[model samples]
Structures are given as structure tokens and as C-alpha cells.
Target: MRSIAKPATQHTITANAKVVDQLPFQDRQAYADARQGFIGTIDPLVITDDSGRVVWDLEQYAFLQDESPTTVNPSLWRISQLHMAHGLFKVTDRIHQIRGFDISNMTVIEGESGYIIVDPLTSVECARAAIELVYDHLGERPIRAIIYTHSHADHFGGVKALIDEDDIHPGGVRVVAPSGFMEHTVSENVYAGNAMYRRAQYMYGQNLSVDPTGMVSTGLGIALSQGQISLIEPTDLISDSGQELVLDGVRIEFQFTPDSEAPAEMHFYIPEMRALCMAENVSHHMHNLYTPRGAQIRDAAAWSRYIDEAMRRYGHKSDVMFICHQWPVWGTDSIRDFLTEQRDLYRYIHDETLRLAAHGHTMVEIAEMIEFPEGLATTWTARGYYGSLNHNAKAVYQRYLGFFDGNPANLHPHPPVESARRYVDFMGGAEVILAKARRSFDDGDYRWVAQVVNHVVFADPDNTSARELQADALEQLGYQAESAPWRNFYLTGAQDLREGVRTDEATLGTSDVLSAMTTDMLFDYLAIRLNGPKASGRNFTVLVHVTDTGETRLAELIHGVLICTPVDGHADADTSVRLDKPTLTGLALGAATLTDAVSAGAVDLSGDDELVYDLFTLFDTFSRSFDIVTP
Candidate 1:
């Protein structure tokens, strides 16, 4: 499934309150020193069953088992401490939650008969740990229902770990979600699954060994649980504007927001508790207009409108308002104020940027021109930790219209590698650029050094000194960022430039998401990486025959454009490649070469052999660094 949210790997992370207090690194210090700065006040971390017997905890021998210690960067070490501080908190008289497990909190609602779960954490191991925590605190209770607040993975990815179908029994526990939740849930991650997963490694700091000065607060919170992922389809769906329902005796007032932060999302109000559950729609820091990992641009205007609507409808009444991330607010005034600032943050960025661009300014100029008024920026909640005003402003311009300013001269831009080389050639040469960059670096002007050295490296990628300096500049920037995501992006880039990005790791998605991917989305996903322009007006047509479905389709390349159409049940073409789904997946991942498949006869081809080369030609690649910031 497309993971709409970040990794949600909070299970293994720990955010240090004061990095200085942590001890010096020893062997296996990454996991050993996890409980460094701020951990829970309790004597021991343990969750027991009803009988007070031990159940789940910071796994039994976690420190001993974990060998890698990512302690060099203190910020990442600090963030990792947050996960180490996690525990199951009491929400109400009977309800409980395993907090700090993921960005999305898993609520355990106690029904008269059993338990009703809402939004299990991201991974199976973490969810299982959470369930044991609940049983230990509240006495054992059967699971009666599972409610997914939205389509995001953190909400549902751990279903299997929590409860199985056999546990639901004759009167199956109900599984509820917003309308089209299944479609949104599965499609979000898979279509562009490969590239998104790759970028997510940086966005989530997946491969980076955690430590202070490295990866910290994942823009959303601490890192997510690195446990098994699983999913289950919802049996009930909420589709209206205001829908009220009773599940397991608790009354839930759902504000159906189909296309807000997610394509399928909703928020709920608990009347008896006077609590408003604002899903990911409203968060601790300014939200993204566009996330670093790829996805359609979220509507800032629509997001603000929904928050305002939440304020008007439920604000004055909420005694304690809690969200998917961060700590909950208890006072009504405080709740209302937080909602207002978050809503206005999005609105301000949207309106002021368009206001400036109406006169004249390029995307970069608009980004530099617009800043949150001093009042908004000073407020802790509205700071550009996750979504900076600079980038979000540009996203707004990109959203409502195209990149061009109605000027023909600026419409087409040269490709990056080509332009970078020309730029270096015109500006003396790589050696000259490095010398000037070295001076800037020595002066502690990291931003300028990054700009100058990046040009040299992008122009001539082999220059080791340029790469080292740029990486050094990026590492310092990472240390200073208040936002966790920015820290991750900067540090990940630095780590890559220093040691180079690691081998592309494969992500095994949950079955629910994998099953929902449409055939069209599969091909379109591949097209994103197809090396286009290289094909350069080349013409090609080939037939792909499906083994499982007995379906036939023809792919046509005309004028460097690729098109797929379902032809005569079994389209006749120059090539009729034969392969099963597993082999096809292997082909996509490059586990086996085309020739290997051909030799093995796993793939049968006919007509012209050169057509395979033409088909592979249309792929376009993506870059980890494409100049998000200035030169």
C-alpha cells in the first residue's frame, strides 16, 4: 500500500531532551544508550497481562541484541530517546493508549464486552506490544472492533499484529473506515512505490544510524516502529459531511473530510468525554503543502477551511483536544488557539504568496519574499519545522498554476546535468569553483559554500573535494534545523555525499495495499522512471500478455510518448513476452536481467529483438538533490 504518512517507526527511536547528559558512546551504544536523556519516570518499563504477568515492553533484550550505535549525530540520538520514553497512557476512565508508538496514536476503547481499537500503530511488533500493554493495564479484554480514522498506513498497517480473523469469530468485530479508504490506502504508496520508498529512506532517515546531530524529530515526531506491517479492509465506511454513529456503546461524531490531508480522512468528536480527535489534519508543526516524498499537492486552502470548520463546530466545547501526534491540550482556550494558528498558517502562506506573484516574482523570489508575520513565527506551533514558509510558498504557486509566469523566455529550462556543466565552464572551471568554495567554508559560511560547491559537483560529479565540502556544509545545516524532517533531509544528503547512498532496499508492503494496485497504475509507476528524451521520437509497439488474468494489452510509443491500450482480448504484436507475476516483479526490481529471463525461457519474445531496447528507452530518472534551495 502507498504509505501516506511517514515510516511511523517510533518503536525503536529515542529523542534526547539534553544531548549533553547522554553518556559517551561504547560498542553497541546506539541501542544501549537509548534511554539517555528523558525517559519515563516509572521504575521499570513493563506491560503485564491481567494477572500482572509481564507482556510487552522496550523488548526484553533490545539493548543487547542491537549492535549498531548511531551516536555521532546527537540530534538523532535525541529523537531516538523519545521512543525510548514511550509508555501506555490512560486516556479516560476506561480507555487507554500506547503513546509514542507512531505518529498516529492507537486508542483502546473498552466496550462493556471487549475492546474497540482505533488506529493501530504502523508495525506489527509495535501493535502487538501495544495490545499487551492495554491488557496489562485494563485487565484482559477481547477485541470487539477496529476503526481506521483515515487511509494513512500508520492507522491500519498493524492490524494483523493486534487481532486475527479467528479472534473476531461468528459476530465478527467491525472494521470501519472513511469511504474509498481502501482505494486511497493501497494506491497512495504502490503506484510510485519504488521511488517513494527510496526517497522515504531520507525523509524518514530509514538507513541513517540515529544519534545527536543526525536525524531528529521526524517533522511529525520521533521515528516509527521497525516492526512487521499488516493491513485489513474496513467493513464499514463513513461518507457524509457529519455522520454520527455508536460503536461498542461509545458515541462518535465523525466529520467526514474526504479530501483533506489524505484522499480519504476524517475527524471525530466524543460527546461524553468532550474530546475532539483531530487526525493528521491538524498537527504540532506547520504541515506540508507538499511532502518531500512524492504525492499530489495537498490543498492548503481546503486544509485551512476544514480546521476553521472544526473550530466553529467543536472548539468552544472541547475540554481536552488530542491529535494523532504530540501531547494533548487540556484547556478549551488553548485548544481553540492551537487550531486557529495552524489553520491561519496555511491560509497566510497561500494568500500572501499569490498576492506577491500577481505583480511579478519567480518561484524562488516568491519563496524569499514571503515570510510568516512575526506574530505567527514566534508561536511555537506555527514554525516551519516540517513545512517551511520558503518551500510551502513555492508549492502554493505550483498548485494553482504552472511554473511559468506567462513568459516565453522562461518556459523551457535546460536539463540539470547539462546546465550545471555549462555553468561551470562559464565560471572559470571546477578547480576555480572549489578554491572559492574552500574560502567560504573556512569563513563558516556554510550556505554559500553549499551553493558554490554544489555547482562544481553537479557539473563534474567526480570531484571528491567538492562532494566532501558540500557534505560538510549540509551536516552543519542539519544540526541547526529545528524541524526533524529538514534535519533528516540535510543529514541524509550529507551522509550520501560522504559515503554515497546505500543500495536500494526493497520494501515489502502489506497485502491489503498490494492487492488494490490497478494494472494501469503499475505501468504508470514504471513510466515515472523511464529514461525519456533518450527515446527521442522513437516509435515502438509491443504486446504484454498476462499469465494470471489471460489478458492482453499493447504498449505504443509515438513521438517519444508512451501509451497503453487494451487491445483485442489478446493483441497481436511484434513481441509477446511471457512471464508470471513474481517474475514480472523481479524484472521491475532488476533482480534478474532481461537476458537472464530470456535464457531461462521465463520470458518469451518474438518479432524484433531491438524493440526491448526501445521500450526501456522511455524511462526518466529522479534525483535526490535537484536544488530545493538557492545557488
Candidate 2:
């Protein structure tokens, strides 16, 4: 993949810098709240693993210390500056947070014998560093328990970092999470893992630099840390509301919130501390209902009701409220206001969109028509830093109704390349489209220019003039965007158009995730890879036996469908392969071929070798670096 070289153009700079004057600069309360309980920071904030390789570093974002540049959004620049605040800070008397160590914050609560860590960051290195910071300041203390607030990778990926697997063996240490946490965590990433991971490159702007014109902040934090991601199965699951657990003298009340920000999510309240852990449900900015990275659309109504339920249950009692991302809220009144407004933000988007949809308005029409009421819109936390109203409204529409807008014309519209060819042909040619786009670009109609120029680029990707013009228009749109992901997507698209799509290898295969996959889960992933067209009219049964685990399963491919069934043994199988879980994972991931596995004595083959080869050949490998913008 080529490096990003595109810079903000003159139009982008002027348009973005003007936004600074429009926003209310008097609102410095967030800054004041962010620095309230500061204790100290690791000077120069650079963390390295045992091998002395840098895993998490803040020096690269040193440019944020300066005033917002013309190329960056001032509101986003202000938040980036806030997120740059690093180190151990006291949330209250017994609660402390190690922020800026990773994209997510690690919270530590004082227990009777030791510390209880909540929602460790994205990687083992970063999570380890975060705990080390806590110990460095607060003195050495054993971790008695660990709590995962949600099922997202950032919340639970660093399990082995703070506490060893041996420590949790036989329930030595308590690991608490909501029900279905493990299933959702693995399934969300593994089934559609490649596609989602690829789109995440754009959503998180990982390819961009840490400069004013590049990646400033992800709205949630500065950026995700690069390190090893590991997971530990939960020892205890929070199944319902009012379910309480007393660990190390701290009492936690759970509120189950499945299908909110994540498929498996929940919030907890500490009775002794009078503190509420809102999880990812209530972050500083509006959260994503339909993340740009691509996942199942969240239920906005259920999301709103959960917040309302949290408010009803613990709002008045809680003195301070802290979440997985951003700073905590102090005082009962302030926390109540924050929760209520955030609740209404989602409620309004959901209710209003449905009302418009019932009026026969399409998704795009509803998204443009719906607007935040003045009461909710005026609140700073209600602003779209992570999730915008535009996309969230569309997500609501998609949840009830699907992508189909009930229009026959859009029911079976032409694909991008085909439609682009037709569109360009109908509008004269590339030259004519460019001519009209140039006029729109000059008139500050960047949205229209982007829409039209995309057709030109799709019709002829090699058209350098069209590519540059589209890039220019995208740059301007990015500058005007308040949502971080929107800005990142637009700018990254522009960058890729000018350069080329990034071709880096997917990192999911290298993570500890694959080792955690069960045999059933692995087979389900294999079923996703089965080529239906290629397997048509083919009938075969393969019995897989694991020598290490003494587990056996039968996979039958018939009529273009693969079905897996657990059995003691299959007497009349077409083929049988005996291997351990690791070898099986290798074969599924294309790390090792069936022939190579047999040659290396890692796999024992029986029945027919030709049948086994045919079965393996029926699976298709998806490219991790597929094109997004161009055809």
C-alpha cells in the first residue's frame, strides 16, 4: 500500500477554520471537568513491552499542543487536546482512572485486599502499562477481580495482560461480564471479520498520520494502541437487572443491556462508592448506532430505554458517573442531566425517524428531514463526535425497515460500476461531468460534486483529473464534518483516491482470537467460506477427529449447503482427518494446506485423499484489501 500524501487544499482550510468562529468557545467546562482529579503522569508517556518495543506512545500527537490549524476542525481539535491528558487521576476517594494509556480508559477501584480492574484497554501491552502506572503510583496491589463492561474488542482484548490465565484457573480470580459476552465477541469479529476489519481501516483512520490534516482523534480517544489482543472467558455472567455481586468488599449491581452499543453489554453500579459505571452506553459524545466499520444495526429504542432505566434505578443515588471512554461526571445533578439528555438524543432520533418513515419518506429523506430538538441539541454531550444524527437516523430506518426505501426504482438498482457507466454515458462524457462538477465545487456545493465525481471515477478510475477533483471535494466535506468518523472516512477516501487503496495484511489472523475459537465456531466460520455454486450437486461427508481433545464431528456437504453434526464416530464417512485444534485452525486460515499438514505428520488422513482435497477446494478465500471507493 502506498503512503498517504494528500494534504488539505485551500478550500478545505478556509471552510474548516471558519467553523472555529461559529462554535461556542465559552464552553470550557469539559476541560475543567477532565482535569479535576489529576495526580501525575508518566513523563513523555511512552510505554514499551518486555522486549523494549514501543507499544503505546503519545509523542506522535505532540502537535496537538498547538492551536487548531486551518486544516482541522476546531471542536474536534479541542477534544483531542482533552484526550491528550494522561496518567493516574483520582475519580473519587476509592476510584482511580488511568486515561490516555489506550483508546479506552482503565478504571481501578480500591478493594478490601487489592484492586478490581474494569474494562482493560485494547491490547495486552497497553493494559499492562496501564496497571503498571496504577501500581507505580498507588503501590503494588494484587488484582482480585476483573470486569468487562461490554463485548467490544477494546474492553476485553487485554485480559491476559493484567492477570494470568493461571490466576483465573479454578476461580482464583473473579471475571464478571454480561451473558453471551464470549459468543458475541467472537462471532461479531470472526464471521464477517475480514470485511469489517477492512472497513475499520477507514472508520478509525489507522492509515492516516497523527497530524492536523491527518488523524486528530477518533472522538472516543486519540487512537487504538498497536499490541497483542487476548481474551479470557468470563467466570460469572450478569444475566438480569438487580443481579448483584460482592467482590473484595465492593458491591456491584448489574443492569443488563444487550443489543445496545454492542450485542452483549451491561452497566453496573457500586453501592459503597455511590458510583455508576455506565459502560459504553453513555460516553462523552453521541455513540454509534450503526458504526461505519459495519456491524448489525443497534436498536435505538432499546438503547434509549436502557439509559432511562439506568437513570431511574441509580441516577439519584450516584454521586459520580464514569464510563469506558472519556472523563467522569461528578455530582448527582450533573450526572442526571447528562443521562437524561443522552437518553433523549437517541429517543428523538428513533421516534422522529419512524414518524417520517410512516409518512412514506425514504431513509435518505428521513435522515435529512429529522433534526435534534433545541433542548437536546444545545447540550455538548449530545453533539455528534462519534455518531452523527445523519447516519443514526438512517440506522433507525434500517432497523425497522431495511435498506429498501420501498421504492421500486431502488429495489434492483445497478451496481456502482454499471450505474456509473450508464450515468457518465447519459451525461455526455467524463469531460462534461468534470465541467459541471467544477462549477458545483466553486459554488461550495461539495456534496453534489462528490456524488457526481464518484460516477466519473467509477466509470474511469484512471482519470487523474476526475480523481483529483473528487479528492478535493471530499477534503472540503471532511473539513466541515463534526463527527470524527465522518471526517476520517471522507479524508481517507480522498487520500486513497489520490494514492491507492491500502494493501496491508489483515491483523485478525495474528491475534489471540483464533486460539479462543471453539471447534463449533471454527466450523461455522468454515461454513461461511463454503462456495455454494462450486458445491452444487456434490455430496460428501467428512468426519473430523481431534486427537488432543477426543472430539469428533461430521461435516456434510449436500445440495450447496454444509451441515455440521457432533457424533461419536461416522462409520460410512467419505473422508476422515484426525488433527488437533491448532492444525485445524491453520487449515481453516489457509496458513497450512491439507497436503502440507499430512506431509508434516500433523494430520492423519483416512477414507479417500481425493475427497478430502475436493472438500478443501470447495472453500473460497476472501481478500482483506478489497476496493471500497473505485469499482
Candidate 3:
């Protein structure tokens, strides 16, 4: 990764920093609450995996030990300091949380015989470190059960860290999750996995150094750990609201909140402890309705409704409200107020965006027009640390109305490169655009400068002056951004423009995730990889026999679409191949070639080798470092 020049300071940026400093620094309640249940942390928190590769190192953020620098937003810096509070802390008598170990918290609840873990952190190494920390302070107890609140990889990707496949007994050690957990988990990570993983580099600031001007806290936490991720299928599924389960003498009730934070998400209530676990529904910061890394747009209406439902069901009964991301809310009044404010935040965004759209406003217009009411705006929880009102308002409009704003002009816009070239030509050339952009940059009109200079860069990618001006404009926007991901995206774009896009090789999915993928899920991923243009006018049928699973699939490519169905055998198939699931996985992941598999006796072929080779040729490999800021 290339090092970027320090962001240039402008009068507008300094004024923005002054405005942030004046806004409610007197509220020290969050700080007090964060340090409430402190126990102890491992001295010099540096964790490594079995291979001696560093997975997570809190020392990288040692700069946060100092006061907020002028380059960083004070509010975000405050949160970053709080997030630097790493260690094991007792949430209550039986419940404990290991915070700052990873991007998310790994919670442990003491059961009668053993322990029940909630959301093992993002990676195997982090989860293991967290568990070991608990065992060092508390006794080494067996893990009787594991619960995943949602389908996101960060919540359950560390299953192998705590327990093995042999430890799972039907009635002894249970793995629990909401309905559609496995489906959403596999679909989100497999079908669009390559693109999302690539964009995540920018979203999480993975390659950037930790500093005031570089990567700070991600609002939820520092960032994701670069360790191996694994997955385990859940044994129990919570389907509906009010679903109750008694495990290890602890009575727990579930509130299923599908399509809220995730496709399959739920909040649970522990009656005995009077504790409400809000999962990812109500984190410390405002969450994204549309994450920049890209996924299906989340339902704002559905999200608010679930929070309201939780309030009605457990708000009065719960004494402590703990979430997966940040600190807990202890008092009844505080918990209720927190839930209500969060609920209203989402509802306001949802309703106001729709209202503006109903009045014939475009997505961009609605986003610019809407603003949070004073009651929500002044509140700390409603601040745009993770999700910004600007983008989320657009996301709301997109939820009801799509990308098209009903304007015929935008209905069929030209591709980026063609449009950029035309725009540059209309503006007299790259030199004219650069002159105008330089004036805007000097005047601190970075938004306009970025927009104009983008056309110049796209029209003439090799123009050094155009690239430098664009990078400067982007860096200014990044310095003034309140949202961590917004800042990261801008800075990363600037870095890429200056140094050229990085071409680091990133592996798509881990072996545990591949092994857990269902046959249908694997086929869905394969269908995405199928190049429609390449397969056009080419019809073929193949029978795949998985010897280990004893299942066969018949695939047909017709009219530029691949359709696969489970079948016993296909007599008219052009080719038949016998391979185990592992070998098939290796083939899909590009780890094993058709020739290599055949030569090694891992794949047995019965018919036309050329046909099989041609089918493989139709599959397109995605590059992890595809260009984003440039055409």
C-alpha cells in the first residue's frame, strides 16, 4: 500500500472542527458507563494465530491514547478512545463480555453446567483469544451452546475457535440461530462475495495505517481481524416471536426480527436476568440501511417496527440492555429512552424520505432536504458515525422508489467512460476542467471540484494534473466527513488515484465456509460466475456425481443461462464426472484445475473431456482489485 500525503488544511475544515468541538462535550455519561464493569485486560494486547501471523493488535491504535487531534473529528475520537478500552468485564453476575477483542463483542453467559456463548467474534484467532481470556480469569468451563443473533459473517464466523464438530451433541451442545440464517449467510458471502470483499478493503480501511489522518474506529469498533473465518450450521432455529427455550436452567425468550439489521436477525430476552439482548438492531451508533460495501438495501420501516416491538415486549421488564457492538444501558429509563430514540431515528428517515418522494422529489433532492429534528440530532446515539443522514435518506427513497427518479433523462444514461469523454469535450477539454476544478478546490468547494475533476480523470486517466486535483478534493472531503466509512472511502479513493489501484490478491472464502455451503448454494454461486455472453448459443448438459455425498446434479446451459437440478442420472449427458465435494469445492475456488484433478485421480471422467473443459471456460474469474474511482 502507498503512503498518502497529509491532508491539506483549509479554513472550511478548521471551521467544521470548531463547530464539532462546541457541540455537547459536557456529556460524560457514555465515558462513565463504558468503564462500569471493568475487570482486566491482557497486558500488551497482541494476539496471533497458530501460524504466528498477527490477527489482531490493539497496539496499532496506541495513538488514540492521546487527545483528539485537529485532523480527527472530536466525537469520533472520543468513541475511538472508548473502544480502546480492551478487556474482560462482567456484565452482571453470570454474563460477561470481552470487548475490543475484535470488531464485535464475544459474550459469555454462565450456564448451570457450562457456558453459552453469544456471537463468537469475527475470526477464529480472535474468538480463541477471547475464550482464553475468560478461562484465565474465570474457570475453564465447557461450552454447552452457542447462539448467533444474525446471519452476518462477523457474528458466527468463529464457531470453530471455541468448539469442534465432535463436541456438538444433539441435546448437549446446541448451536442456535434465527430462521434463514444459513441461507442468508451463504448467499451474502458467496453470490456477491468477490465484489463485497473487494469493497470491504475501503470500507474497513484494511490496508491503511492507524493514525489520526488514516484509519480510525469504524464506529462499531476498530476494524475486522485479518484471520481465518469459519462457520458452523446451527442446531436450533428460532422461527417466530415469543419463541422460548430453556437451556442449562436459563430461561430465554426470542424476538425474531428478520430483515432488520440482517436478512435473518433476532433480539432475545433473558427473563431470569431481566436482560434484553438487542443483537445488532440497536448498536451504539446509527447503522447503515445501505452499507457502501454493497448488499440488498435494508428496510427502514421494518427496522423501526422491530425496535418498537422490542420496546413493547421487553423494555419495561429489562433492567440492562446489552448489544453486540458497544456498552450496555443499565437503568430502566435509560434503556427505554435509548430504544425510543433509535426507533424514532429510523422512522424519521423512513417517513420523511417517502413524504418528500410523494411530493415529486428526486432521491438526491430528498436526501438534501431532510434533516433530523433537534430531539434526535442532539442525542449522541443518533449521530452519523456509522450511517449518515445524507446517504441513508437516499437509501430510504431507493427502498420505495428505485434508482430511477422517474426522469427520462436518467432512464438510460451512458456508461461512465463515454459520458466522461462527452462531458470533457463539452467543457472544452481536460485543461479547462482542471482549471475550473483548481479554482473550486482553492475556494473549498470540494464537492463541486470532485464532480468536475472526476470527468477529467475518466476522460484522460493518464493526466497527472487531473488525478492530483481529484485526490486533493477527495482528501478534503475525507477530512470533513463525520462517518468513519465515508472518510475511509474518500481517502482510499484519493490514495488509489495517486498510486494507481492496488492489485493485492485476496482469497474469496475459507474452506470451512466452502464446506458448509449447501449444494443449492454452491449451484447459485456457480450460476453467478457463468458468463452469459460466452455461453450464448452453446447448449450442453453435464452430470456431476459427488461420491462422498452420494448426490448427483444435472446441469444445462441454454439461452445464456445455466440451470442445475438434482437428479439421479442423465443418460443423454455429454459428459459425466465423478468427484467428491472437497474436490468440487477446490475446482470452484480455482485451487484445482480440471487437468490437475484428472491427472491426480481426484476427478474421474467418463465422457467428453473437451465439453467439460469448454464449460469451465465459460466461467469468469473476478479480480479482487477492480478499479472503482476511475473508469
Q: What is the lDDT of candidate 1?
A: 0.67
* Candidate order by decreasing lDDT: 2, 3, 1
Candidate with top lDDT is 2
Candidate no. 3 TM-score: 0.98
Off by over 4 Å in 2: 1-18, 50-52
lDDT of 2 by residue, 208-229 (tens): 8768777888988998987888
What does candidate 1's lDDT look like per residue over 159-190, in tens digits? 98777766555567888788989887767876
Clashing pairs for predicted structure model 3, backbone only: none
Candidate 1: RMSD to truth? 8.7
RMSD of each: 8.7, 1.7, 1.4
Q: Which candidate leads the pack in TM-score?
A: 3
Compared with the true structure, the alpha-carbon lDDT of candidate 3 equals 0.86
lDDT for 316 in candidate 2 is 97
Q: Which pairs clash inside model 2?
A: none
* Cα lDDT of model 3 by residue, 1-631, tens digit: 2446675476445756775665687888888888789888887988898989999999989999897776677777877887887889888879999999888998899999999999998899999989999999888989999999999878987889998888777666889899999888877867787888878888887766678787888877888887888888888999999999987878899999999989999999998899999999997778999999989889999999999999999999989998998888997888999999999999999999998899999999988889898888777898888888899999988888899999999999999899999999999999888887788888888899999989988988888899888988887777777788888888888889888887866556436876677776666677888899989999988898889998889888889988988997555688888999888877776556788988999999878878888988988878899998888
